[model samples]
Target: MNQASRDVIRPIRADEWPKAKELRLLALKDPVAPIAFLQTYEQAAAEPDSFWREQARESARGTRVRQFVAEGLEEIWSGTVAVLIEDAGSDDAFGGAVLQRQAHIVGVFVRPEYRGSGVIDELFEAAVGWAWSVEEVARVRLYVHEDNARAESFYRRYGFMRSGETVPMKGDPSKEEREMVLDNPQLVSDIS
Candidate 1:
């Protein structure tokens, strides 16, 4: 079947914790996992069931975080991306101050067979759409590892531009993760 016919992009429900955990573990095992994520398969895989439950619940509706999944044939998830809202001047998870109210996209992963099949684009559309829907969100942003050219290029194509902010990669001080931003042009035009 074609990509569109086989896939559905939607927000993950609180009860879908098992599916969420499974997809994350699979993503961490992919060949490019090292550059794509901050956690290792061992670490994520070792987490308790309660941890997964909490994680899923936190990303459900009514929270500041949301996880969107692309479920392909047979209801299996083919890709996932998560967004976390950050308030301006508040310290981020990495100890850096957020410069503005924005949604931070993270944990992007797509199954190998689904790569380049527009799965990522669909996931991004859902994620960015949610980000823009927030009342105080001025834009959306994400960080790409300096060496992750494939990911960086994808984000660029999605309208995200380098924001000139860099953060040291966790556990890899020599490398950097550059911040990219996509301003809410609709909001900008409205304000003008």
Candidate 2:
């Protein structure tokens, strides 16, 4: 069977900070990291262990944010995605005003060896599914760098459409990131 088929997709536990930090550092070293992520490897690596521990702890709580990981046999982590709940009238991670209650997907990363193995699909499914479970979350969204075609294509295929919104890329105002959104399917069905 394929790795993806055998992998378990679930949220990271508070005690899994070490593993989370390792995976995040690895992601930062990826070739497309420059465009795929806002943080640099050097910056992330410089963070104290407390940072990762708190991050994992908060994500595990699943109250405001959650980080899901794809785990295979022997507890090997293959990928991760984080969802941040944004309340209406609150500022988002990018300092923009959130117009509605929503879930913003971020820090998406899958190991190179697991790409196209269906791991990404599972991760996204879990993230989006959890987002919809939140009360009053009207939609889900993410920002993709204009030059990250691969990520943009995958987001499009996963039912996210361009929202015609753009934001200056963090640390690089000369470049922009495009916003893509996916309305809550449950809400859509209800309206229909």
Error of 1 at 123 (Å): 0.4
TM-score of decoy 2 = 0.97
lDDT by residue for model 1 over 71-173, one digit each (tens)?
Answer: 9778979899999999999998679988889899999999998898899999999999999888789999998999999999999999999999899999998
lDDT measured at residue 74 in model 2 versus the true structure, 0 to 100: 80
* The best candidate in terms of lDDT: 2
Query: What would the per-residue lDDT of candidate 2 be over residues 1-192, giving only the tens digit for each residue?
Result: 788999999999999999999999999999999998989999999999999999999999999999999999989999999999999999987888999999999999999999999999999999999999999999999999999999999999999999999999988899999999999988889999
Give the TM-score of each candidate: 0.96, 0.97
Candidate 1 off by > 4 Å: none
The C-alpha stretches of model 2 lying farther than 4 A from their native spots are none
Instruction: Choose the strongest candidate by TM-score.
Output: 2
Candidate 1, 89: how far from true, in Å?
A: 2.6
